[model samples]
Target: MTARVLVAGIGNVFLADDGFGVEVVRRLAGVELPAWAKVADYGVRGLHLAYDLAAADYELTVLVDATARGDEAGTVHVIELDTGRTEQTPCLDAHGMQPDVVLNLLAWLGEAPRRVVLVGCEPEVLDHRMGLSPSVERAVGTAAGAVVDLVTNHGR
Candidate 1:
């Protein structure tokens, strides 16, 4: 059976704190998840992610990434995107890992998951570093838990 949910961890690991999603997914590897769910680390592979979404009929696609919303670092936010609204014409960049761009590309391909959620963390450092800042590091577990909850509960 095809998976009903797709949990994608996207970001650039070379950039500090931007690797939050990658770290979270790595942690998720140790947790138990529903069989109908597929988890993957699609770091900076926006084109690949867009293709996957278009090829599958997943009901929900959860994107975990580092997002800056002017809040304190390490803060995690769960955002639900309105897939029906296409306010801006997204520009396609093969290397771009931004969630919106991937989703827009899915739409452009005439396919999209029924729902999209972004589990994001406020990044402390997006510099050329290999690891996350202290605060962002601490939030990795929380974000992983959030992803599990969202998928297990089917986004309830």
Candidate 2:
């Protein structure tokens, strides 16, 4: 059976700029989409996201987050992850959702999704502050749109 598509926003809303993914998904929640498109906010629980991916519930997964890619703040990026390059290694902590570990866990499950995309925003601040930084806030909608595009444009 063809798995569905998942758009998961991963980050902590309590931390400044880190909340970009949560905000993006909040915006997406109101938008109309196909039944196969599943959107969720997986804040701080990287392990949860990992197990979900391991379930192979999605043919394609779009993970939205604030990534420190050394780019300008608020920069939106759509990066396609080569899951084939993922290693089948398990992490010690299965309680946290470290993005890299989550992806790796999927490979360890031996049924990783066919495609994984990362829709990230460069964060201005990741300190212990609620809400997104001004720069990151501006990119939320753009990232949401990007996630939608990834799902709709996927060939499988």
Candidate 3:
């Protein structure tokens, strides 16, 4: 049987520019989508998301987050994590315990999704301030649309 597809957006809304993922999810709230697809605003609970991914009947998982890799503030990129490396490795706990660490651990624990895609946005700032930078906000629509297309095509 074909499994469901989960599209999750993770970030800390309180931090400036860090909330792009969650904002994208919010924009997707009213979009008409196939039944096998689920979209969520996960905030910052990476470990919980890993467990959720493990428990869900999903064959494909799409994760959205912000990356510090220097691109334009609103530039978006998609990456596929290596299943073997993610599953067999212990991730470093840098800058506090990261959610990717949990994702890698879940992969190790046999809860890995059959296919995973990470949609990352380059952020200009991640300060303890309010609102996304103008550039990041501008890319939300394009990113959200891309996510929808990915789910619609891959959810089968």
Q: Which stretches of candidate 3 lie over 4 Å from their true place?
A: 1-3, 85-99
Give the Cα error of residue 49 in candidate 1, in Å.
0.4
Model 1: pairs clashing at backbone N, Cα or C within 3 Å: none
List the global CA lDDT of all models: 0.90, 0.81, 0.78
lDDT of 2 by residue, 1-156 (tens): 244888898887877888888899999999987877888888878877777777656778888988888999999999888776464476747434456777777677675667888899999998988988888888888898888878788774
Over 32-81, each residue of candidate 1 has an lDDT whose tens digit, in order, gives: 89899999999999999988888888899999999999999999999998
lDDT of 1: 0.90
Clashing pairs in 2: 46-97, 47-96, 47-97
Candidate 2: global Cα-lDDT? 0.81
Model 2 misses residue 36 by how many Å? Answer: 1.2
Give residue 112's lDDT in candidate 2 (0 to 100). Answer: 63
Q: Which residue pairs show collisions in model 3? A: none
TM-score versus the correct structure, for each prediction = 0.94, 0.89, 0.86
**Which prediction has more favorable TM-score, 2 or 3?**
2
RMSD of each: 1.5, 2.2, 2.9
Ranked candidates, highest lDDT first: 1, 2, 3
